[model samples]
Target: MKFLFIAPRFHNNQYYWVKSLTDHNHEVRFWVWRKEPLENYSALTPSLIPRSSFGLPKILSCYREMKALDPDIVVVRDPRSFLFVFVSMLIARMQKRKVFIYSQTPLYQTMSWVKKITVRLMLRFFGSLWITPIIGDMRYPKFHPRAFYVPFAIEPQAQEKSPVRRPIRIISVGKIYQERKNHLLLLEAFYDSLKKSDIRLTIIGALSGNSPEYFNKMRVYIKKYDLEQTVEIKTNLEHNEVLREYAKHDLFVLPSSNEPLAYSPLEAMGAGLPVICSDTNGFRWYVKDGENGYIFKSEDVSDLKDKVSLAIPRLQEMSKNSLNSVKQFYTPKSFYEKFMEAVQSV
Candidate 1:
């Protein structure tokens, strides 16, 4: 069967899902709201095609193009992405085709009344399936009639990590955004941990173009404590290169409070590294407290630091648990099966 995917962007994990479908002997054509790839992300193959215009023109242009492509099933990223959803659903239903809405809607966030009504109306008439990547209870607020969950797939590593190294290297990957990514909060917690134990931290992410204020602030804080040797900050590593860096560390921490879903923690878990993330991470379920890793209270420096201390001794055990936990569910084979089930169910 032919599947057409339209999304705002082709994120790293997004590529894996598409790859899953293609590997299962299906044809897929991916489209995006923009033509260019993200700052540090690239498509796996058969590059993403961008929508041509804005407003009605975009809907019409894409509607015409999708009709031309003539897919067996149309899969869109989000219901909120009206152009893609609207056109895909309308056109697909017109041809008696099926639609899958890849709605990674966060349970933490509430939908506006206008959007709620709009989405319900679309699903009611056009008959689309609501598919989400975010798993566990943190998914959208149990609203969709036929909602299906598909955890984002990853290529997990088979190698297990060595025993925890002193100066237990903890790594966090995200953009340097103080308000969202919470780099400063992590730095403060890491600094507090330093007084008690010998631990090292390596931060990896992309940077804003110029006047990287948050990056500079983190640098200043490191300078203030003379921690340049222990706490290393790296920027602009490719996705695969980031995985190589993950192999060098024993722990993964994503301190962001408002992350809808993060790929880093999942990727780290897939690589046999124990993960510690904030309570609010949408994929927080992947980190089983006291088993695979810990989940600290959001923005609590002491709590975050304490979890790190607790994890130090059992890092290897948790590493095994992390591998056991993630590999069972978040694999490409799992995605292919689940996606096909959703398609057949509809």
Candidate 2:
């Protein structure tokens, strides 16, 4: 089957999916809104339509491209790409083909009425929906059957046995979103629990330019609490650099709340690092508590500290379990099989 995927950007996880599907004898093409400089995704050579160039010309270009490809299925991966997907859906309908929405957006009851109406109309006319299974209490009232659970896949890396560091290196990766990622919470927990111990906490990711105030606040907190030495903040590392960082770390921590199946933890698992995350995160579904990883209460510093302290002593066993779990459940081949089944059913 020929599948055309439209996304805001071609991420490493999406690249794995494209490679997996093509390897399985399916023709896969991609159209990305923009390309990130740090991402190593030139292998696919996806067609690019810059986000700034989203006008009538781009819309017509997308329509013409879809008509030319005449794909068996069109998969839209970004909710923000509604105009592009709508064009693809129109072309698909005219060709008697199918369109599917692969979304990470949670359809919670508290969602705005406008978004609810928009989703309803899309499901009514576009095609079936595939969403992460871990979205919390979020349901499409009228499109439950059309929605299928599709987990993200990771390319596993070969395990390298290394001596564990005495300082118990821990790493967290995410944008510096003050309220959403809750990095401050993780910092507080780390400072309260592991400060005296010989442990190092590194928070790595891009600092959102839009949230400079929050970023500055974090810096101030790091200084005021004298966590300057204990905690390190690294920003804007390349994709390969991130993997190297993950390799050096003993544990992965994500203290974010309301996440819809984050890919970083899965990548960490692929690198054989045990995960410590908030229970509210959607990806917590993959974590078998006390087995591969531990889930702490969201925003609860005491509980997070307790879970971190408990997991510190058993990192080796948990790390092994983490590697084995990803190998068993999160491979690209497994994801491809499931994706094929879902597409066929649709």
Candidate 3:
């Protein structure tokens, strides 16, 4: 089947989804708001089409491309790019083509009544909605009547069983939208949790452009709490380097106060490290408290500290569970099949 994907950036999550469909013998085409140099990431090829920066040019280009492809399915990734995607789908529909959206976010963070009604109206036309949650408990927009939960998947790796816990190395991975993910609380919890233990923390991810103030604020707190040695703050690393960090670490923590479903924890699990995340949708699904990993209160430092302390002792068992869980549920093959199921349903 031919599939067309429109997203803000053709990297990371969007790239993964597109690649999954393509590998499954489905033709996948993408048009994004902008394109980075191909060298910015791996597994990205020359096939993904480029579109306008935004506005009318992007809408026209996307519609024109979709019309040319006449795909079996048209999927939009980012909500911000939905304006063009909606128009493209309407144009595609005019040609009797099916349209859908595959996303992890809702229409709004907390929808006002009017916005809720608007979303209900908007969703009515979507043929399918695909979401990947760490957990499957999210209350997605109404158009999700045909919604499918296809959790994030990771490439397989050799799993080394931890026989006994030694130094407790902790790692946090993902784009550093610290406030959205509540990295400040994580920094605080990491500092407090390590006070009586031999654990160390390393944060690996790109800080969002809007987070300079938060980064500076975190710096002040790190200095004040003397956590410079305990918590190492760094910038973007290659995906494998991030995986290496996961292998080196005993625990992975992402205190996203409000997360739909995050991909990092699943990747960490693939590396055989136990995860601790907020009690959000994604965490609720995979983390079975003592089974695979721990789930702390979304924004509560005390709860995060408590859960971290609980997880430290069972590090070996949790690591094993983490790897086992990922193998069972979050593989690329499974994701591809699940996605195809959704699209075929459309």
Residue 9 deviation, candidate 1, in Å? 0.6
Q: Write the per-residue lDDT of candidate 3 for residues 1-346, one digit (tens) a residue.
A: 8877666566564546656776777887666656543223555443444445543545555557667777887776644346655666566666676666566654223547885565456556544454443334346443335556666778757756656555678888766645676778787777756666777888877765655777777788888988777888777676566667777778888888666677778878888888888876455567778788888767788988888888878888888888888787778877887777766675
Q: Give the count of colliding residue pairs in each prediction.
A: 0, 0, 4
lDDT of 2 by residue, 178-292 (tens): 5678888888888764558889889887765676877787899999989888888988788778878888899899999977667789889989888988877888878989988
lDDT of 2 at 144: 48
Give the Cα-based TM-score of candidate 2 against the true structure: 0.86
Estimate the TM-score of every prediction: 0.89, 0.86, 0.84
* lDDT for each candidate structure: 0.77, 0.76, 0.68
Residue 326 of model 3, lDDT score: 75
The TM-score obtained by model 3 is 0.84
Ranking by lDDT: 1, 2, 3
Give candidate 2 regions above 4 Å deviation. Answer: 50-57, 78-81, 105-124, 128-143, 160-163
Residue 40 of model 3 has an lDDT of 32
> What's the residue-level lDDT of 289 in candidate 2?
92
* Candidate 3: residue pairs that collide: 134-282, 135-281, 135-282, 135-285
The predicted structure with the larger TM-score, 1 or 3, is: 1
> Model 1: per-residue lDDT, tens digit, 112-134?
88877876876778766778776
Error of 3 at 326 (Å): 1.0
Number of clashes found in candidate 1: 0
